[model samples]
Target: MSDHVEEQEMEAEALEAIFDVSFSVVHDAQPFVWSVRLVPVDCGGDESEELEHNHVAVKLVATIPPTYPEDCGPELDVEIERGLAEQHREEILGVARDEADANEGMPAIFAVCEAVRGWLADNNEKGLEDVSMHAQMMRKKKDEERSKAKQEQKFESQKKAEEMTEAELEEIAVRKRRADGTPCTEENFLAWKEQFDKEMEEEAAREVAEREREGGSNKKKGAATEIKSRRDAEREGRPTGYELFSGKAGTMNLEALEAAAEEAEEGSDEDDAVTVEDLDVDENLFDDDDDLDDLDFDDDDCDEEEPEI
Candidate 1:
C-alpha cells in the first residue's frame, strides 16, 4: 500500500510539473485526471472575428496512469469542441501517439502537447486550416474506397465469366434485352440499334471462325482416312482383276502373265507357245458331203439289221 501510494504521488508530481510548463491544466483531484491544454492549436481561445459563433477549439486530454512512462505507453485522447471531421481527429491523435512513443520511459504529456502545438502552429496561424486538411483527407479516403469497389466488381465479373460456358455466354449475349419497362425513346432506340449491330457483327465473326475451324478439321480427317485406306490396301498386297487391267500395276513385270493368259484363251496352256492356225476355224466341218455320208450309213445299217437278228 505504501509503495502504491508513493508511485501515485510521484506520478502526480510529474503531472504537476508538466502542467507548469506554459499549459492550461484542469485539475480533478479525486480521480487525478489532468486535461492538459496544448497551446497554439486552434483548440478555441483565439480572437479572430470572422468565425462562426458556434465554433470552439480542439482539445487534447490525458488521464494520468499510475504506470505511465514506466510500464505502459501514453494513451492520448482528443476532445472535439464542435463539428469536426474524423480525419483531423485521427491525425491529431496519431501525432500525440507518435510523440508519446518517441519519449518512452519518460513523462510524455508535455512532449505530446508540444508536438501537437507545433503541428497546429505550422499549418495555421488562424484557426481554419483544419478545414482544407480535413477535406483532402476525406477525398483521399473516398478515392481509395472507389478504387477498391471497382477492383472488387471486376473480380466478380471475371468469376462470373469463368463460371459460364462458351455456349452459355454466347446464348446470353444474343438473347439479352433491356428489361426496363419505360417507353423507348429515340435515343434508346439508337443505342439499342448500335448495340444490336455490334453483337451481330461479333456473332458473324465468331461463326466465320467456327466454320473455318470445322472446315480445317474435316479436311484433315478426310486426308487421314484416304491415307489409312491406302495403307490397308498395301497391307493386303493383292490387286483386284479390275486393278490389274486398269493399268494400276504398270510398274510390275507382267509380260509373262500376259503370255499365260493368251495361251489359256487359245487352249494351249501346256506351253506358252501358240500359233494363229491353232485358234482358226475349219469352214468344211458342217458341209453337205458329211450330211450325205451320214444318211447312206443309216440306210445300210437299216438293211443289215433284219438279216443279222
Candidate 2:
C-alpha cells in the first residue's frame, strides 16, 4: 500500500510539473497552450543477445490558439492569440527558456516548451499598429473638415452682419431724407421731384455746356485766312470770268475771229442777195413825195413879211 501511495505521489508530481510547464508556456505565449506527455524509453542496448531497457520516455505536443479578430467575443480571442504570437515572441521564448532551465533533464517539459514555441511561430497575429494608424488619420481628416466648416460659417456670419449694417444705413438715410415736408407719393412727389430733378439736370447740363464753351473760348485761334476779292484776284494775275469762260482770251488767234466774222458776213450776204426783180414795188411812193413838195412853197413869202415888221 505504501508503494502504491508513492507511485501516486510520483504521478501527481509529474502531472504538476507538466501542468506548470504548459501553463508557463501558454501564459508567455499568451493565448496558446501546450500538451505534454511522459513515455517509457529504453536507454540500455543489448550486448551478446541480451537487451537492456531504459525506464521512460516523454513527448510534448502543442497547438497554437487561433488568431483573434478586432471584434467582440470569439473574434477577440483569436485576435488576442495572434497579438500574443507577434507582439510577444520574445516573452514566449523567455518562458520556454525558463521552463527548460527549471526542468532540466525533463524531456516532457522541454518538449512542451518547444512545441509551444513552434505553435507560436506558426500562428502570427496581424499587427494592430496599422489599424491604429488608420484610425488616427481618419480622426485628423475629420478634424480638418470640421475646422473648415467652422471657418466657412464664421465668414458667412460676418458677411451677413455687414449686409445688415449696410441695409440699416440705407434705411436711416431714407428716413432722414423723408423727414421734411416733401411728399413721397407717386403723383405729387414725382411732380415736385421731377421739377427738382429737371432743374438739377438743367444745371448739370448748363455746367457741362459752360465747361465746353469755356474750353472752346480758352482755345487759341488760328490766323485769319485772307480771301481775295474778284478785282484783287484779277490784279494778282488770276483768271477773270471772261478769261475763264473764253479759254485764254488774249491768246485767241485772229484767224479764228476772222473765220467766224466771215461766216457771219456770208450769212448776211445770203439775206442781201434778193433781186429787185423778185420783189413787188409800192405804186404810191411817187405821189406821197409830190404832195409833200406842193405844201412847202408858201414858207419864204411868210418869213419876208415878218422880217419887215
Candidate 3:
C-alpha cells in the first residue's frame, strides 16, 4: 500500500511538471493569460457521467515575453536580432511564429532548448576564431604601414643628400677668387701686375736719386774742407809763393842789397809781402852791374853761394 501511494504521487508530480512546462511555453509566446481551463466531455457511448473528453483553453489578454529572439533558432540569435531590425518583414515574423508553435509541448521545448544551447556554444567558438583572425590581420596591416613609412622617410633623406651633393659639386667646379681675396678675372689681375711694376720702378728711381744727391753733397763738402785748410795755413804764415821766391839769392851789391833789404823790411809790414827771413839773399855782395848781370845763377848754385855756407 505505501508503494502504490508513492507511485501515485510520482505520477501526479510528472503531470504537474508537464503542465508547468506547457504554461511556461505559452507565456513565452504572449504577455498575459486572461483565463486557463480544461473542460471534459464524454466520447464513444460511455454514458458514465464522470468520463468525458477534455479540451484545454488559454485566452491571452496581454502579450507575455513581449518580444521574440527576433526570429528563429537560438543558434542564429545574434544574426536574427541584428537581421530582423534591418529587415522587418513577414519572413522574420513567420520564423518567430514557427518557433513558438514547435515549442508548445514540454518534450519539444526541452529538445529544442538542448539543440539551441549546443548551436550557441559552437557559434561562440567560431566567433573566437574570427576574432583571432581579425587581430592577426590588423597586426599585419600595421607592420606594413610602418614599413612603408620608413621607406618613404629614407627616400626623402636620400633625395636631400643628393641635392646637397649636387650643390657642393657646383660650388667646387666654379672658380671664385684669389688667395689675396681679390677677384681672379684676367683684366683685374693684369691691372694689378702693371700697377705693382710701376710702383717698384718709381721706388727704385727715387732711391737712386737719393744716393746721387748724397754723393754730390759729400764731394762739395770735401772741396770746401780743402779750401778752408788752405786758407788757415795762409793765415798762420806757413810757406807761401812770395816766401819761396824771396830767398837769400834775391840780394844784390851792398847798396842795392841794403836798398832791397829796406824795401823788404818795408814790404814785410804788409800781410801779403815777403819777410826778411824768407828772402833767400846773399849777406855780402858787390854793387856792380856787371857782376849782377854776369851772375850765372842756378837754383843749386844760389843755394851753395849763400853766406851761411
User: Could you say which candidate leads in TM-score?
Assistant: 1
- Candidate 1, clashing residue pairs? 43-57, 43-58, 44-57
List where candidate 2 sits over 4 angstroms from the true fold: 1-85, 107-309
Global CA lDDT of candidate 3, please? Answer: 0.44
- The lDDT ranking, best first, is 1, 2, 3
The stretch of ten residues in a row with the least summed lDDT in candidate 1 is 300-309
Per residue, candidate 2 scores C-alpha lDDT tens digits across 228-265 of 35446668876677664343544333334334444454
What are the per-residue Cα lDDT tens digits for candidate 3 across 1-309? 343334333433453464443222223222321111111222333434323222211111112222222322222111232112222223333443455467642222233323333333222211122335675587467669879999999999999777787668667555443333655799998999999999999999999999999999999999999999999988886555554445423543333434444555456545554445544555555546677787774434433433531
How much lDDT does each candidate structure score? 0.63, 0.45, 0.44
Error of 2 at 12 (Å): 10
Clashes of 3: 19
For candidate 2, the per-residue lDDT at 258 reads 38
lDDT string for model 1 (1-309, tens) is 444346655765775675554344454443345566544433244345414332334578776555655766656798754444566678888999998899987767767878876765543323333568776687567669879999999999999989999899888766664443458899999999999999999999999999999999999999999999999989698867765544455422234434444565568746556543333333344366857565543433433433211
**What are the TM-scores, per candidate, against the unseen true structure?**
0.33, 0.15, 0.20
RMSD of 2: 34.7
